[model samples]
Target: MSLLDDDAFPDMDSVSRDRVAPYIIRTEKRKAIDANGKPLFRPRRTQMAQVAWETRHHLQQLLYEAVTDYVREGYTTRPCARRNATSVF
Candidate 1:
């Protein structure tokens, strides 16, 4: 089953709906727990954002290092259409 019901979010665009659907499900679960007198531990938005930024940054760094290594090994002059192509990320 989909996390988000299309009928409930008919006006939302696909990308935005996808991003928010999980959060909506989490909030509903938290509310259910709260009704049962259980403590809810929601993460701060800043912390989540920081983690995403760090992950993206690390991936970019790795891509840069790979490209640099390929170039340093005298592969820059070769055409990129080969089976073992070196792509710049």
Candidate 2:
């Protein structure tokens, strides 16, 4: 059965509720609504793999910048540390 098939597993309701809580809360808050009082939007399905990849890429960039700054600021003068920092890219 598909994971989204809530009827297959009743316990999934609570699990899914927690997972999509942000979207549900936003909808309930009426932050964005049309003239008729309906919500202006619905939440899109989460792309787990894409999200994971983007998060990894962003974190890697942050780490690389931090290491580069450390080396540039002379926080560590060891040749090995300098070489290792450059390899992060």
TM-scores of the candidates are 0.23, 0.23
Give each model's whole-structure lDDT. Answer: 0.53, 0.57
lDDT of 2 by residue, 1-89 (tens): 13654554456224443444443434454367889978787855765563334665988878878889987876657766655445321
What TM-score does structure 2 among the candidates reach? 0.23
Give stretches of model 1 more than 4 Å off. Answer: 1-56, 74-89
- Measured with C-alpha atoms, the lDDT of residue 48 in candidate 2 is 50
Model 1 over residues 1-89: C-alpha lDDT tens digits?
23456654454233343445555534454454566687575643553343334765988878878889987775855665332342211
RMSD of 2: 18.1
> Ten-residue segment with the worst summed lDDT in candidate 2?
12-21
As a TM-score, model 1 comes out at 0.23
lDDT of the structure predicted as candidate 1? 0.53
Best by lDDT: 2
